[model samples]
Target: MKPLVVLVGATASGKTGLSVELAQRLDGEVINGDSMQLYRGMDIGTAKITADETQGVPHHLFDILEVTEEASVVQYQALARQTIAAIRERGKTPILVGGSGLYLRAATDVIEFPPTDPGLRAQIEAELESEGTAVLREQLREADPESAAVIKDARRLVRALEVVRLTGRTFTSFLPQRNHLPSLEPVLQLGMKIERSLLHERIADRVHQMHSTGLLEEVRRLDAAGLRKGRTASAAIGYQQFLRVIDGVLTEEQAVEETIIATRKFARRQETWFRADARITWLDTACEQLIDQALEAVRG
Candidate 1:
Protein backbone atom coordinates (compact mmCIF):
# COMPACT_ATOMS: atom_id res chain seq x y z
CA MET A 1 0.00 0.00 0.00
CA LYS A 2 1.14 3.54 -0.73
CA PRO A 3 1.71 5.85 2.21
CA LEU A 4 -0.58 8.65 3.32
CA VAL A 5 1.45 11.79 3.98
CA VAL A 6 0.22 13.54 7.14
CA LEU A 7 1.39 17.05 8.01
CA VAL A 8 0.65 17.94 11.64
CA GLY A 9 1.69 20.85 13.85
CA ALA A 10 0.72 23.60 16.27
CA THR A 11 -1.61 26.36 15.09
CA ALA A 12 -0.04 29.03 12.82
CA SER A 13 2.90 26.67 12.33
CA GLY A 14 2.91 26.94 8.49
CA LYS A 15 1.12 23.65 7.80
CA THR A 16 -1.13 25.24 5.19
CA GLY A 17 1.65 26.75 3.07
CA LEU A 18 3.87 23.70 3.36
CA SER A 19 1.08 21.28 2.50
CA VAL A 20 0.28 23.20 -0.65
CA GLU A 21 3.90 23.03 -1.72
CA LEU A 22 4.11 19.35 -0.82
CA ALA A 23 0.94 18.50 -2.70
CA GLN A 24 2.18 20.31 -5.80
CA ARG A 25 5.40 18.34 -5.57
CA LEU A 26 3.95 14.94 -4.74
CA ASP A 27 0.77 14.94 -6.85
CA GLY A 28 -1.25 14.70 -3.66
CA GLU A 29 -4.64 16.10 -2.70
CA VAL A 30 -4.89 18.03 0.59
CA ILE A 31 -7.39 16.95 3.25
CA ASN A 32 -8.58 19.27 6.00
CA GLY A 33 -7.78 18.18 9.57
CA ASP A 34 -8.57 21.40 11.41
CA SER A 35 -11.97 21.08 13.04
CA MET A 36 -12.86 24.76 12.74
CA GLN A 37 -12.14 24.92 9.03
CA LEU A 38 -14.93 22.48 8.22
CA TYR A 39 -17.63 25.07 8.80
CA ARG A 40 -18.72 27.27 5.92
CA GLY A 41 -18.53 31.08 6.28
CA MET A 42 -15.93 30.75 9.07
CA ASP A 43 -13.04 31.89 6.92
CA ILE A 44 -11.50 34.77 8.85
CA GLY A 45 -11.75 33.34 12.36
CA THR A 46 -10.65 29.85 11.42
CA ALA A 47 -7.82 31.11 9.22
CA LYS A 48 -9.22 29.00 6.40
CA ILE A 49 -7.04 28.84 3.30
CA THR A 50 -8.45 30.73 0.39
CA ALA A 51 -8.62 29.28 -3.12
CA ASP A 52 -5.76 31.61 -4.01
CA GLU A 53 -3.71 29.98 -1.30
CA THR A 54 -4.44 26.49 -2.65
CA GLN A 55 -2.68 27.35 -5.93
CA GLY A 56 -5.11 25.25 -8.03
CA VAL A 57 -4.45 22.09 -6.02
CA PRO A 58 -7.53 20.17 -4.87
CA HIS A 59 -8.52 20.45 -1.21
CA HIS A 60 -11.01 18.26 0.62
CA LEU A 61 -13.42 18.37 3.58
CA PHE A 62 -13.30 22.13 4.13
CA ASP A 63 -16.35 24.34 4.45
CA ILE A 64 -18.50 21.25 4.10
CA LEU A 65 -20.83 22.04 7.02
CA GLU A 66 -22.69 25.06 8.29
CA VAL A 67 -21.61 26.71 11.55
CA THR A 68 -24.72 25.37 13.28
CA GLU A 69 -23.74 21.77 12.69
CA GLU A 70 -21.59 19.85 15.13
CA ALA A 71 -18.47 18.03 13.91
CA SER A 72 -16.56 15.38 15.78
CA VAL A 73 -13.24 13.61 15.39
CA VAL A 74 -15.13 10.36 14.87
CA GLN A 75 -16.99 11.81 11.89
CA TYR A 76 -13.78 13.27 10.55
CA GLN A 77 -12.07 9.91 10.79
CA ALA A 78 -14.81 8.25 8.77
CA LEU A 79 -14.94 10.94 6.12
CA ALA A 80 -11.19 11.30 5.89
CA ARG A 81 -10.76 7.56 5.45
CA GLN A 82 -13.28 7.59 2.63
CA THR A 83 -11.59 10.59 1.01
CA ILE A 84 -8.13 9.05 1.33
CA ALA A 85 -9.34 5.80 -0.18
CA ALA A 86 -10.89 7.67 -3.06
CA ILE A 87 -7.71 9.63 -3.62
CA ARG A 88 -5.72 6.40 -3.62
CA GLU A 89 -8.09 4.88 -6.16
CA ARG A 90 -7.30 7.81 -8.41
CA GLY A 91 -3.57 7.15 -7.95
CA LYS A 92 -2.92 10.26 -5.90
CA THR A 93 -1.37 10.58 -2.46
CA PRO A 94 -3.65 11.80 0.31
CA ILE A 95 -1.95 14.56 2.27
CA LEU A 96 -3.72 15.17 5.60
CA VAL A 97 -2.78 18.62 6.82
CA GLY A 98 -3.56 20.90 9.79
CA GLY A 99 -2.90 21.39 13.53
CA SER A 100 -5.82 19.23 14.79
CA GLY A 101 -4.14 16.28 16.48
CA LEU A 102 -7.27 14.34 17.35
CA TYR A 103 -8.61 14.41 13.79
CA LEU A 104 -5.23 13.36 12.43
CA ARG A 105 -4.75 10.60 14.99
CA ALA A 106 -8.26 9.32 14.51
CA ALA A 107 -7.69 9.07 10.75
CA THR A 108 -4.68 6.83 11.18
CA ASP A 109 -5.74 4.71 14.13
CA VAL A 110 -8.37 2.05 13.51
CA ILE A 111 -10.36 1.48 16.67
CA GLU A 112 -13.55 -0.44 17.24
CA PHE A 113 -15.71 2.16 18.91
CA PRO A 114 -18.23 0.40 21.10
CA PRO A 115 -21.98 0.75 20.67
CA THR A 116 -23.55 3.92 22.06
CA ASP A 117 -26.65 4.29 24.24
CA PRO A 118 -28.65 7.22 22.90
CA GLY A 119 -30.72 7.69 26.02
CA LEU A 120 -27.65 7.68 28.24
CA ARG A 121 -25.96 10.09 25.84
CA ALA A 122 -28.92 12.46 26.05
CA GLN A 123 -28.95 12.22 29.82
CA ILE A 124 -25.27 13.12 30.03
CA GLU A 125 -25.73 16.11 27.73
CA ALA A 126 -28.63 17.30 29.87
CA GLU A 127 -26.43 16.90 32.95
CA LEU A 128 -23.68 18.89 31.25
CA GLU A 129 -26.10 21.70 30.47
CA SER A 130 -27.60 21.78 33.96
CA GLU A 131 -24.66 21.00 36.24
CA GLY A 132 -21.76 22.48 34.23
CA THR A 133 -18.55 20.79 33.05
CA ALA A 134 -16.88 20.76 36.47
CA VAL A 135 -19.38 18.21 37.68
CA LEU A 136 -18.85 16.18 34.54
CA ARG A 137 -15.08 16.34 35.06
CA GLU A 138 -15.53 14.91 38.56
CA GLN A 139 -17.53 12.05 37.10
CA LEU A 140 -14.89 11.41 34.46
CA ARG A 141 -12.14 11.49 37.07
CA GLU A 142 -14.02 8.85 38.98
CA ALA A 143 -14.77 6.66 35.98
CA ASP A 144 -11.75 7.13 33.72
CA PRO A 145 -9.04 8.85 35.70
CA GLU A 146 -6.36 8.13 33.09
CA SER A 147 -8.40 9.73 30.31
CA ALA A 148 -9.49 12.56 32.56
CA ALA A 149 -5.89 13.57 33.25
CA VAL A 150 -5.10 13.82 29.53
CA ILE A 151 -8.30 15.49 28.32
CA LYS A 152 -8.02 19.26 28.79
CA ASP A 153 -11.44 20.63 27.90
CA ALA A 154 -14.72 20.12 29.72
CA ARG A 155 -16.39 19.23 26.42
CA ARG A 156 -13.90 16.42 25.80
CA LEU A 157 -13.93 15.15 29.39
CA VAL A 158 -17.69 15.06 29.43
CA ARG A 159 -17.79 13.09 26.21
CA ALA A 160 -15.23 10.60 27.54
CA LEU A 161 -17.18 10.09 30.72
CA GLU A 162 -20.43 9.84 28.80
CA VAL A 163 -18.93 7.10 26.64
CA VAL A 164 -17.99 5.06 29.68
CA ARG A 165 -21.24 5.83 31.47
CA LEU A 166 -23.31 4.74 28.52
CA THR A 167 -21.32 1.69 27.48
CA GLY A 168 -19.77 0.45 30.70
CA ARG A 169 -16.41 0.32 28.94
CA THR A 170 -13.21 2.33 29.17
CA PHE A 171 -12.66 5.21 26.74
CA THR A 172 -9.23 3.89 25.82
CA SER A 173 -10.82 0.64 24.76
CA PHE A 174 -11.89 2.34 21.55
CA LEU A 175 -8.56 4.05 20.97
CA PRO A 176 -5.00 3.21 20.08
CA GLN A 177 -6.86 2.85 16.80
CA ARG A 178 -5.57 0.00 14.65
CA ASN A 179 -6.60 1.77 11.42
CA HIS A 180 -3.55 4.00 11.74
CA LEU A 181 -1.09 1.14 11.49
CA PRO A 182 1.82 1.82 9.12
CA SER A 183 1.68 -1.76 7.89
CA LEU A 184 -1.74 -1.08 6.34
CA GLU A 185 -0.38 1.82 4.36
CA PRO A 186 2.82 3.78 4.14
CA VAL A 187 2.16 6.52 6.73
CA LEU A 188 4.51 9.45 7.13
CA GLN A 189 3.74 11.84 9.98
CA LEU A 190 5.37 15.26 9.62
CA GLY A 191 5.03 17.88 12.31
CA MET A 192 5.82 21.50 11.56
CA LYS A 193 7.56 23.31 14.42
CA ILE A 194 8.24 26.97 15.13
CA GLU A 195 9.96 28.85 17.93
CA ARG A 196 7.60 29.80 20.77
CA SER A 197 8.20 33.51 20.50
CA LEU A 198 7.78 33.50 16.74
CA LEU A 199 4.62 31.37 16.95
CA HIS A 200 3.10 33.81 19.50
CA GLU A 201 3.93 36.75 17.28
CA ARG A 202 2.38 35.03 14.27
CA ILE A 203 -0.76 34.24 16.25
CA ALA A 204 -1.15 37.86 17.35
CA ASP A 205 -0.63 39.08 13.82
CA ARG A 206 -3.18 36.63 12.46
CA VAL A 207 -5.76 37.71 15.02
CA HIS A 208 -5.16 41.34 14.11
CA GLN A 209 -5.48 40.50 10.44
CA MET A 210 -8.77 38.72 11.09
CA HIS A 211 -10.18 41.86 12.67
CA SER A 212 -9.02 43.98 9.75
CA THR A 213 -10.80 41.55 7.44
CA GLY A 214 -14.09 41.93 9.35
CA LEU A 215 -14.03 38.96 11.71
CA LEU A 216 -16.46 40.89 13.92
CA GLU A 217 -18.94 41.14 11.07
CA GLU A 218 -18.63 37.44 10.46
CA VAL A 219 -19.44 36.71 14.08
CA ARG A 220 -22.36 39.10 13.89
CA ARG A 221 -23.68 37.25 10.86
CA LEU A 222 -23.61 34.00 12.75
CA ASP A 223 -25.27 35.54 15.79
CA ALA A 224 -27.99 36.99 13.62
CA ALA A 225 -28.54 33.47 12.34
CA GLY A 226 -29.41 32.46 15.94
CA LEU A 227 -26.07 30.94 16.86
CA ARG A 228 -25.07 31.70 20.44
CA LYS A 229 -21.58 32.17 21.81
CA GLY A 230 -21.41 29.07 23.99
CA ARG A 231 -22.65 26.83 21.19
CA THR A 232 -20.36 24.68 19.06
CA ALA A 233 -20.27 27.41 16.41
CA SER A 234 -18.72 29.70 19.00
CA ALA A 235 -16.03 27.19 19.92
CA ALA A 236 -13.68 28.54 17.25
CA ILE A 237 -11.18 30.92 18.90
CA GLY A 238 -11.77 34.38 17.43
CA TYR A 239 -15.53 33.95 17.21
CA GLN A 240 -15.73 32.98 20.89
CA GLN A 241 -14.01 36.13 22.15
CA PHE A 242 -15.57 38.47 19.62
CA LEU A 243 -19.03 37.21 20.61
CA ARG A 244 -18.31 38.63 24.08
CA VAL A 245 -17.56 41.98 22.50
CA ILE A 246 -20.79 41.86 20.53
CA ASP A 247 -22.75 40.99 23.66
CA GLY A 248 -21.21 44.09 25.32
CA VAL A 249 -19.52 41.95 27.94
CA LEU A 250 -16.09 42.88 26.60
CA THR A 251 -14.52 45.88 24.90
CA GLU A 252 -13.01 45.50 21.44
CA GLU A 253 -9.51 45.78 22.87
CA GLN A 254 -10.32 43.20 25.51
CA ALA A 255 -11.71 40.88 22.87
CA VAL A 256 -8.58 41.13 20.77
CA GLU A 257 -6.34 40.53 23.78
CA GLU A 258 -8.45 37.62 24.93
CA THR A 259 -8.46 36.13 21.42
CA ILE A 260 -4.68 36.26 21.26
CA ILE A 261 -4.26 34.78 24.71
CA ALA A 262 -6.78 32.02 23.99
CA THR A 263 -5.05 31.18 20.71
CA ARG A 264 -1.66 30.89 22.43
CA LYS A 265 -3.13 28.62 25.08
CA PHE A 266 -4.73 26.46 22.37
CA ALA A 267 -1.41 26.19 20.59
CA ARG A 268 0.25 25.07 23.80
CA ARG A 269 -2.38 22.39 24.19
CA GLN A 270 -1.80 21.30 20.58
CA GLU A 271 1.90 20.93 21.31
CA THR A 272 1.09 18.76 24.30
CA TRP A 273 -1.22 16.57 22.21
CA PHE A 274 1.25 15.94 19.36
CA ARG A 275 4.30 15.55 21.62
CA ALA A 276 3.23 12.13 22.79
CA ASP A 277 3.10 10.71 19.28
CA ALA A 278 6.62 9.44 18.71
CA ARG A 279 6.00 8.70 15.02
CA ILE A 280 5.99 12.36 13.99
CA THR A 281 8.92 13.90 12.11
CA TRP A 282 9.41 17.43 13.42
CA LEU A 283 10.29 20.09 10.82
CA ASP A 284 11.23 23.58 11.91
CA THR A 285 9.89 26.25 9.55
CA ALA A 286 12.81 28.49 10.42
CA CYS A 287 15.11 25.99 8.76
CA GLU A 288 15.15 25.98 4.94
CA GLN A 289 16.22 22.34 4.99
CA LEU A 290 12.95 21.16 6.52
CA ILE A 291 10.93 20.64 3.32
CA ASP A 292 13.56 18.70 1.49
CA GLN A 293 14.10 16.57 4.57
CA ALA A 294 10.38 15.85 4.72
CA LEU A 295 10.24 15.05 1.01
CA GLU A 296 13.12 12.63 1.44
CA ALA A 297 11.38 10.96 4.35
CA VAL A 298 8.16 10.59 2.38
CA ARG A 299 10.00 9.16 -0.64
CA GLY A 300 11.86 6.67 1.57
Candidate 2:
Protein backbone atom coordinates (compact mmCIF):
# COMPACT_ATOMS: atom_id res chain seq x y z
CA MET A 1 0.00 0.00 0.00
CA LYS A 2 1.13 3.59 -0.64
CA PRO A 3 2.02 5.60 2.41
CA LEU A 4 -0.48 8.16 3.69
CA VAL A 5 0.57 11.83 3.61
CA VAL A 6 -0.50 13.49 6.87
CA LEU A 7 -0.34 17.29 6.65
CA VAL A 8 -0.83 18.85 10.04
CA GLY A 9 -0.41 22.41 11.38
CA ALA A 10 -1.79 25.12 13.60
CA THR A 11 -4.87 26.98 12.46
CA ALA A 12 -4.24 29.69 9.85
CA SER A 13 -0.69 28.42 9.23
CA GLY A 14 -1.58 27.78 5.54
CA LYS A 15 -2.34 24.05 5.76
CA THR A 16 -5.40 24.25 3.50
CA GLY A 17 -3.78 25.91 0.50
CA LEU A 18 -0.67 23.75 0.73
CA SER A 19 -2.68 20.56 1.13
CA VAL A 20 -4.80 21.37 -1.90
CA GLU A 21 -1.73 22.01 -4.03
CA LEU A 22 -0.01 18.89 -2.70
CA ALA A 23 -3.09 16.80 -3.44
CA GLN A 24 -3.25 18.11 -7.00
CA ARG A 25 0.42 17.41 -7.49
CA LEU A 26 0.43 13.97 -5.88
CA ASP A 27 -2.88 12.79 -7.28
CA GLY A 28 -4.23 12.47 -3.74
CA GLU A 29 -7.68 12.93 -2.27
CA VAL A 30 -7.91 15.18 0.78
CA ILE A 31 -9.50 13.77 3.94
CA ASN A 32 -10.78 16.08 6.66
CA GLY A 33 -8.97 15.55 9.95
CA ASP A 34 -10.21 18.68 11.63
CA SER A 35 -12.88 17.78 14.19
CA MET A 36 -14.99 20.90 13.71
CA GLN A 37 -15.01 20.61 9.94
CA LEU A 38 -17.08 17.42 10.29
CA TYR A 39 -20.19 19.43 11.04
CA ARG A 40 -22.47 20.79 8.37
CA GLY A 41 -23.20 24.55 8.27
CA MET A 42 -19.99 25.38 10.15
CA ASP A 43 -18.04 26.37 7.07
CA ILE A 44 -17.08 29.94 7.88
CA GLY A 45 -16.17 29.47 11.53
CA THR A 46 -14.21 26.29 10.94
CA ALA A 47 -12.45 27.85 7.91
CA LYS A 48 -13.54 24.95 5.70
CA ILE A 49 -12.15 25.02 2.21
CA THR A 50 -14.47 26.26 -0.46
CA ALA A 51 -15.45 24.01 -3.37
CA ASP A 52 -13.50 26.25 -5.72
CA GLU A 53 -10.52 26.18 -3.37
CA THR A 54 -10.46 22.38 -3.53
CA GLN A 55 -9.07 22.80 -7.10
CA GLY A 56 -10.87 19.70 -8.43
CA VAL A 57 -9.43 17.46 -5.73
CA PRO A 58 -11.88 15.02 -4.19
CA HIS A 59 -12.34 15.66 -0.48
CA HIS A 60 -13.86 13.37 2.11
CA LEU A 61 -15.36 13.68 5.62
CA PHE A 62 -16.26 17.37 5.49
CA ASP A 63 -19.78 18.40 6.57
CA ILE A 64 -20.72 14.85 7.48
CA LEU A 65 -22.47 15.63 10.77
CA GLU A 66 -25.22 17.95 11.89
CA VAL A 67 -24.60 20.64 14.50
CA THR A 68 -26.59 18.75 17.15
CA GLU A 69 -24.35 15.69 17.03
CA GLU A 70 -21.28 15.15 19.12
CA ALA A 71 -18.19 13.82 17.34
CA SER A 72 -16.27 10.89 18.76
CA VAL A 73 -12.67 10.08 17.96
CA VAL A 74 -13.49 6.36 17.84
CA GLN A 75 -16.12 6.96 15.16
CA TYR A 76 -13.83 9.28 13.26
CA GLN A 77 -11.02 6.74 13.29
CA ALA A 78 -13.18 4.11 11.69
CA LEU A 79 -14.54 6.46 9.03
CA ALA A 80 -11.15 7.93 8.17
CA ARG A 81 -9.54 4.50 7.86
CA GLN A 82 -12.32 3.34 5.59
CA THR A 83 -11.93 6.43 3.44
CA ILE A 84 -8.17 5.97 3.27
CA ALA A 85 -8.49 2.32 2.20
CA ALA A 86 -11.04 3.20 -0.50
CA ILE A 87 -8.85 6.02 -1.80
CA ARG A 88 -5.81 3.78 -1.96
CA GLU A 89 -7.80 0.97 -3.59
CA ARG A 90 -8.68 3.45 -6.34
CA GLY A 91 -4.91 3.98 -6.79
CA LYS A 92 -5.01 7.56 -5.50
CA THR A 93 -2.91 8.80 -2.65
CA PRO A 94 -4.69 9.76 0.61
CA ILE A 95 -3.73 13.08 2.14
CA LEU A 96 -4.89 13.52 5.72
CA VAL A 97 -5.03 17.20 6.63
CA GLY A 98 -6.03 19.19 9.73
CA GLY A 99 -5.02 20.95 12.97
CA SER A 100 -6.88 18.56 15.26
CA GLY A 101 -4.17 16.69 17.10
CA LEU A 102 -6.15 13.87 18.69
CA TYR A 103 -8.25 13.34 15.57
CA LEU A 104 -5.15 13.11 13.44
CA ARG A 105 -3.54 10.69 15.89
CA ALA A 106 -6.65 8.57 16.07
CA ALA A 107 -6.75 8.28 12.31
CA THR A 108 -3.10 7.23 11.96
CA ASP A 109 -1.85 5.79 15.25
CA VAL A 110 -2.36 2.51 17.08
CA ILE A 111 -4.85 3.42 19.80
CA GLU A 112 -7.75 1.75 21.53
CA PHE A 113 -10.61 3.41 23.32
CA PRO A 114 -12.24 1.98 26.41
CA PRO A 115 -15.87 0.95 26.41
CA THR A 116 -18.49 3.40 27.64
CA ASP A 117 -21.42 2.57 29.84
CA PRO A 118 -24.24 5.04 29.44
CA GLY A 119 -25.46 4.27 32.93
CA LEU A 120 -22.08 4.86 34.48
CA ARG A 121 -21.55 7.96 32.38
CA ALA A 122 -24.92 9.36 33.32
CA GLN A 123 -24.21 8.73 36.99
CA ILE A 124 -20.88 10.49 36.73
CA GLU A 125 -22.45 13.40 34.88
CA ALA A 126 -25.02 13.75 37.63
CA GLU A 127 -22.27 13.92 40.19
CA LEU A 128 -20.57 16.56 38.07
CA GLU A 129 -23.77 18.59 37.89
CA SER A 130 -24.69 18.29 41.52
CA GLU A 131 -21.26 18.41 43.18
CA GLY A 132 -19.53 20.38 40.41
CA THR A 133 -16.33 19.80 38.40
CA ALA A 134 -14.12 20.43 41.44
CA VAL A 135 -15.53 17.35 43.08
CA LEU A 136 -14.96 15.33 39.97
CA ARG A 137 -11.46 16.74 39.60
CA GLU A 138 -10.61 15.68 43.12
CA GLN A 139 -12.02 12.23 42.43
CA LEU A 140 -9.90 11.96 39.28
CA ARG A 141 -6.91 13.22 41.20
CA GLU A 142 -7.21 10.43 43.68
CA ALA A 143 -7.93 7.81 41.03
CA ASP A 144 -5.76 8.99 38.13
CA PRO A 145 -3.50 11.85 39.05
CA GLU A 146 -2.01 12.19 35.56
CA SER A 147 -5.36 12.72 33.92
CA ALA A 148 -6.39 15.01 36.74
CA ALA A 149 -3.40 17.28 36.23
CA VAL A 150 -4.07 17.84 32.52
CA ILE A 151 -7.82 17.50 32.04
CA LYS A 152 -9.68 20.67 32.96
CA ASP A 153 -12.94 20.27 31.13
CA ALA A 154 -15.94 18.82 32.92
CA ARG A 155 -16.78 16.36 30.17
CA ARG A 156 -13.24 15.01 30.01
CA LEU A 157 -13.09 14.79 33.78
CA VAL A 158 -16.27 12.81 33.76
CA ARG A 159 -14.91 10.49 31.11
CA ALA A 160 -11.67 9.84 32.99
CA LEU A 161 -13.59 9.08 36.15
CA GLU A 162 -15.95 6.82 34.29
CA VAL A 163 -13.09 4.88 32.73
CA VAL A 164 -11.30 4.49 36.04
CA ARG A 165 -14.46 3.26 37.72
CA LEU A 166 -15.40 0.85 34.97
CA THR A 167 -12.06 -0.76 34.10
CA GLY A 168 -10.04 -0.05 37.26
CA ARG A 169 -7.31 1.28 35.00
CA THR A 170 -5.75 4.67 34.52
CA PHE A 171 -7.16 6.73 31.67
CA THR A 172 -3.67 7.48 30.41
CA SER A 173 -3.10 3.79 29.78
CA PHE A 174 -5.22 4.00 26.65
CA LEU A 175 -3.29 6.89 25.12
CA PRO A 176 -1.62 6.32 21.76
CA GLN A 177 2.08 5.48 21.84
CA ARG A 178 4.58 7.41 19.71
CA ASN A 179 4.45 4.75 17.03
CA HIS A 180 2.27 3.77 14.12
CA LEU A 181 -0.55 1.24 14.32
CA PRO A 182 0.37 -2.32 13.48
CA SER A 183 -0.57 -3.49 9.98
CA LEU A 184 -1.79 0.03 9.08
CA GLU A 185 -0.46 1.87 6.07
CA PRO A 186 2.71 3.86 6.78
CA VAL A 187 2.42 7.66 6.82
CA LEU A 188 4.71 10.58 5.99
CA GLN A 189 3.85 13.18 8.61
CA LEU A 190 4.44 16.84 7.69
CA GLY A 191 4.02 19.84 9.93
CA MET A 192 3.90 23.55 9.18
CA LYS A 193 6.38 25.70 11.08
CA ILE A 194 5.97 29.47 11.34
CA GLU A 195 7.42 32.24 13.50
CA ARG A 196 5.29 32.84 16.57
CA SER A 197 4.77 36.52 15.86
CA LEU A 198 3.78 35.90 12.24
CA LEU A 199 1.51 33.02 13.27
CA HIS A 200 -0.24 35.25 15.79
CA GLU A 201 -0.67 37.94 13.17
CA ARG A 202 -2.07 35.36 10.76
CA ILE A 203 -4.51 34.06 13.38
CA ALA A 204 -5.74 37.57 14.14
CA ASP A 205 -6.15 38.32 10.46
CA ARG A 206 -8.02 35.06 9.93
CA VAL A 207 -10.35 35.82 12.81
CA HIS A 208 -11.02 39.23 11.32
CA GLN A 209 -11.72 37.68 7.95
CA MET A 210 -14.06 35.15 9.54
CA HIS A 211 -16.03 38.00 11.07
CA SER A 212 -16.18 39.89 7.78
CA THR A 213 -17.31 36.74 6.01
CA GLY A 214 -20.39 36.48 8.28
CA LEU A 215 -19.25 34.04 10.93
CA LEU A 216 -21.86 35.60 13.18
CA GLU A 217 -24.57 34.81 10.66
CA GLU A 218 -23.27 31.27 10.35
CA VAL A 219 -23.35 30.91 14.13
CA ARG A 220 -26.86 32.29 14.15
CA ARG A 221 -27.95 29.69 11.65
CA LEU A 222 -26.31 26.90 13.59
CA ASP A 223 -27.66 28.23 16.85
CA ALA A 224 -31.17 28.15 15.41
CA ALA A 225 -30.42 24.58 14.44
CA GLY A 226 -29.75 23.81 18.14
CA LEU A 227 -26.04 24.46 18.28
CA ARG A 228 -26.21 25.30 21.96
CA LYS A 229 -27.66 21.87 22.60
CA GLY A 230 -24.59 20.28 21.07
CA ARG A 231 -21.77 19.96 23.56
CA THR A 232 -18.99 20.05 20.98
CA ALA A 233 -20.42 22.63 18.60
CA SER A 234 -21.38 25.18 21.28
CA ALA A 235 -17.88 25.12 22.73
CA ALA A 236 -16.07 25.98 19.50
CA ILE A 237 -14.02 29.17 19.82
CA GLY A 238 -15.73 31.50 17.33
CA TYR A 239 -19.18 30.01 17.80
CA GLN A 240 -19.02 30.25 21.61
CA GLN A 241 -17.97 33.89 21.49
CA PHE A 242 -20.55 34.80 18.88
CA LEU A 243 -23.27 32.97 20.77
CA ARG A 244 -22.51 35.37 23.61
CA VAL A 245 -22.91 38.26 21.16
CA ILE A 246 -26.27 36.88 20.09
CA ASP A 247 -27.37 36.71 23.70
CA GLY A 248 -26.28 40.37 24.18
CA VAL A 249 -23.59 39.38 26.65
CA LEU A 250 -20.86 40.53 24.27
CA THR A 251 -20.59 43.07 21.47
CA GLU A 252 -19.60 41.99 17.99
CA GLU A 253 -16.26 43.73 18.42
CA GLN A 254 -15.76 42.07 21.74
CA ALA A 255 -16.60 38.67 20.28
CA VAL A 256 -14.10 39.15 17.48
CA GLU A 257 -11.39 40.14 19.93
CA GLU A 258 -12.21 37.16 22.12
CA THR A 259 -12.13 34.87 19.12
CA ILE A 260 -8.71 36.18 18.12
CA ILE A 261 -7.33 35.64 21.60
CA ALA A 262 -8.87 32.19 21.82
CA THR A 263 -7.57 31.23 18.38
CA ARG A 264 -4.03 32.33 19.22
CA LYS A 265 -4.15 30.24 22.36
CA PHE A 266 -5.48 27.24 20.45
CA ALA A 267 -2.70 27.65 17.90
CA ARG A 268 -0.16 27.65 20.66
CA ARG A 269 -1.58 24.43 22.04
CA GLN A 270 -1.49 22.92 18.55
CA GLU A 271 2.17 23.85 18.20
CA THR A 272 2.97 22.35 21.57
CA TRP A 273 1.28 19.07 20.66
CA PHE A 274 2.67 18.70 17.12
CA ARG A 275 6.20 19.79 18.08
CA ALA A 276 6.45 17.01 20.65
CA ASP A 277 6.23 14.43 17.85
CA ALA A 278 9.78 14.26 16.43
CA ARG A 279 8.67 12.00 13.61
CA ILE A 280 7.02 14.85 11.76
CA THR A 281 9.08 16.82 9.23
CA TRP A 282 8.53 20.49 10.05
CA LEU A 283 8.70 22.81 7.04
CA ASP A 284 9.03 26.55 7.43
CA THR A 285 5.94 28.16 5.96
CA ALA A 286 8.05 31.11 4.79
CA CYS A 287 9.87 28.92 2.28
CA GLU A 288 8.74 29.62 -1.28
CA GLN A 289 9.51 26.04 -2.32
CA LEU A 290 7.49 24.46 0.51
CA ILE A 291 5.61 22.04 -1.75
CA ASP A 292 8.84 21.00 -3.46
CA GLN A 293 10.50 20.46 -0.10
CA ALA A 294 7.52 18.40 1.06
CA LEU A 295 7.61 16.27 -2.09
CA GLU A 296 11.33 15.77 -1.68
CA ALA A 297 10.86 14.76 1.93
CA VAL A 298 8.22 12.24 0.93
CA ARG A 299 10.31 10.82 -1.92
CA GLY A 300 13.36 10.51 0.26
Q: What's the TM-score of every candidate structure?
A: 0.89, 0.97
Tell me how far candidate 2 lies from the true structure as C-alpha RMSD in angstroms: 1.3
Stretches > 4 Å off in candidate 2: 179-183
lDDT of 2: 0.92
lDDT of 2 at 92: 92
For candidate 1, the lDDT comes to 0.84
What C-alpha RMSD separates each model from the true structure? 2.7, 1.3
lDDT of 1 at 81: 93
Model 1: clashing residue pairs?
3-186, 108-180, 109-180, 110-177, 110-178, 110-179, 110-180
Top candidate when judged by TM-score against the true structure: 2
Note the Cα lDDT for every prediction shown.
0.84, 0.92
